[model samples]
Target: MSAIKVNQIRAKLRQLFEAHLDLSDIGPTDGERENKILSRCLAALAIYIQTGCTEKEAAESVWDGGDDNGIDAAYFDPSDLRVVLVQSKWINKGAGEPEAKDIGAFTKGVRDIIEQDNTGFRAGLHAKFSDIALRLSSPGTSVHLVLVSTGASVLAKHGTSVLTTLLKDLNGDDPEPIASSEAMGLAEVYSGLANDPLLSNVSVDATMLDWSYVATPFPAYFGVIDGLQLKTWWKTHGKALVASNIRHSLGSTEVNNEIKQTATSTPEKFWYFNNGITLVSNEALKAPVGAASRAAGVFSFRGASIVNGAQTVSSLAKVDDDNRLAEVRVPLRVILLKSAPAGFGDEVTRTNNLQNRVEPRDFVAQDPEQRRLRQEMAIEGVDYQFVRSEDSMATATSCELIEVTTALACAAGEPNLAVQLKTGIGRFFVDLSKPPYKAVFNAGVSGARAFNAVVVHREIERWIDKKKTSMTKKSGPAWGALVHGNRVLSAAVFAKYGSGNLSQAIASFGAAFDPAVIEAHCDIVHAKMAAGIEANYPGKFLAVLFKNPSMSKNVFDLACA
Candidate 1:
């Protein structure tokens, strides 16, 4: 009977993978019904489902199966630096469970990959060998093996024990287990397809209690709930809960670490210590919790997302392993946005997150002037990405967070200031609040001027890249010297275009960005940069150039040259 049930599941899985692989050219008859090629394609498709990667990217990440040594598809998620090893078992038969021997074979395959057994290393895997080896060597890196099976086999107790022992042995003397295994059964597959389609339909189901109706801010509810309940909710919804967040979890930061410490050790004080979570839902309903006054009850919210409190929610979820859920309760505020203003949710997320101890770049991104400019730029069909963090740069995002600040600083006649702030972003959080520095930012400067600054900065950097890439042996060291001179170049360009008036320069940016004119100014800018660097450091290390205010001041003075 169980075998019959598994066969039904296998058929459903076959349909799911086939549909997912349809976009790719991979066909069922690729291997003439041997199913090898189809199985490999299905493995990549399964990985896409788990990681939200596009079908093409997923296919490209697959390792050729001829010498795969058990793994079918592998992708290192750049967002979290997690290596996902996907094993596809496309069993046609109605097997009730995977054979114990088969389970051992999969574990051995993982062992071979970890040990880098050249005997089974295919050319495709070999190409990625260095990256995989480096990631394995890195501390705190996590490896997850997801077994995607058409067969309905739960790893039996003995199978789990064997696999655990094998994994433990492979990890050696590491203080913490670096490897974990998961089985993606039929239900998980179906849920992945149904709930998380490529174009998602946001829906949420939450258990809210001790809630009161608030009519002032549209129709709403104010409630208090245990932190454990929130974690339990996340187990089902996961990433979907915070779909509207500007960025995903950046993994543990100092603030998040403190959140976790408070959650686990001092859970009772969580409500007072934390600001709590904010959620926006399309629709909500109230149910009586006790001899209910209409004012107090449990509210059920749908199409909900945590606009604020992503860090709080993530920290609460982590405390579950230590069984600390019992001690924590947090305040909950839900806004009824069934007919809210346009862009309200984003505004809420941006407004709330800005108050936290975030990166300096993040503060720049939160500037209203920059936000308004970004919206205007989008209207003009230009992508001005203002705040992509380091890990988030896996995909191409033009106009990074630091670059925006650099452009602003240089445009405000402070090229050396831009250079000093470029690297070691954390080192200059204090500067974000201070003088001539703050003047370059959105709050202190007009959007048009800031936008013009970015344009000039990007153009200079683009020219720099073009020049460096075409450098010969004679110019290679020269290119290296000009590397930190980006700030100098930006200042020169701004000065050339802005004509000692940043706002006036912005008003006539079209003429400033002309390729021929920009090229003509490069020689003059380089000369200014060279003179400025020599005057500032003068036989000292490059670090001394930024350390001396006189150097940046000198570079600013050269903008008119």
Candidate 2:
């Protein structure tokens, strides 16, 4: 079976490569063996899968040659600022993984590119050197090492260890990982080929209430669907019901949980509370109930998929009480694509999910405190953008609402508040009149004070980034606490140094504000926090520990001691 599958994949690769790959640059085809040609084709196939680029583009990305380093192919994905480096190993028997030496050579080649040593590379690689270098030099750029193989097994333990060591060395003390690795064996390759859209021509039988149809911009049926009926479809089709949706059902999110709660509790009011579902199909046929009555009717849909309201459908499926579920009525719109223009189905899907999701912070835009802060900050020659939409400007003078909130949370000298912000900042913006929100943005906070706090918070972040580089593996929980519990540490810094007054501290130190003083305070606070971790919360995960109010407070108290 494995051998047959391997042969199938090889045939597919050969078919694809022959159709799209341009082999002119890899020397005369007469001199190359079939295995060697197939190996190069395998690298191009990996690139095509990774980037969704055209087959020609994937083939053009290949740089395999005698002078080529261990890198067989490389493509910079501009969409995510990721440099995808592929090292493909084609094994005819499909039995073994890449050896440790192969892994080492690949890592060394990647290191060479990262270090900007462009010497001794093949002509094909040299052609793309400048573009690759420019992207690698950009901020937020990351390296993805893809070790692709036709082997049945993945990388060995030692090979994995080598990759891990390389990642660690490349990433160093940076908060964001600079490099990561993945080994794609035959199983992965087979799965990619086998994955097809589920239920492409499914037929759904639904009874819709107050049935109505729109015929102007293409035929569309809109009505309310019974929740129980929707659940039945979910049971039958499962994920196939939403295969056309851009985003799958995100299980048990705060919004989804609320959806489940509302469906099970207040079924009648579900229509008013929910945005409802949008389904697209190639055909729709309605059964005639009566000539005078359009109140309710049975409908049949072919090639149907829920392009929107995936969460609603999923949440309804989770409702256990049939009595309550029977009362639930969900609004649904079915778009018929038979007579629609080209790409109409895609446009409908895109537009249905394109609306900006309302967030807790959006409510704060109406708060007078935000307006006051914005005005005051402008008076101080600083741009405080409290409105979420106006936060696109990347000037040094500008600070967004979230940034101000974080800085104020730290400056409040409350470890709990800082920790809360770290865990989930949404709670602080849940209600503008609430404790967390008012606690951070009350009458006492001035423009200068807010600006100063932001300055201090940014400096602490910078300090933490610098501190990360020096951390050894033995740094252990202390290092974890320092990195993960940064907000709590910020609170500790504020508690010790800026407790008197941020304005006074800024006045004393001037606008340039002493980094040396901040660094010293950070050092003291970090050491104390590390000691607290060892003495109070040994072996505890820093991420969870920092979220605990009491644990965070205890650590903060120790740091400020």
Clashes of 2: 0
lDDT per residue as tens, model 1, 340-423: 788876787788778746544555555566677666545544456666544543112235445566677766554555555532
Residue pairs in collision within model 1: none
Error of 2 at 172 (Å): 28
TM-score of each: 0.55, 0.63
**Residue 7 alpha-carbon offset, candidate 1, angstroms:** 8.3
Clash count list over all predictions? 0, 0
Deviation in Å, model 1, residue 318 alpha carbon: 3.5
lDDT score of residue 416 within candidate 2 = 75
User: Which residue pairs collide, candidate 2?
Assistant: none
lDDT of each: 0.60, 0.76
* Runs in model 1 lying further than 4 Å from the true structure: 1-34, 78-81, 97-102, 112-119, 156-158, 170-176, 197-219, 249-257, 289-296, 321-323, 346-561
Instruction: Report the alpha-carbon TM-score of model 1 versus the true structure.
Output: 0.55
Model 1: how large is the Cα RMSD against the reference? 13.3
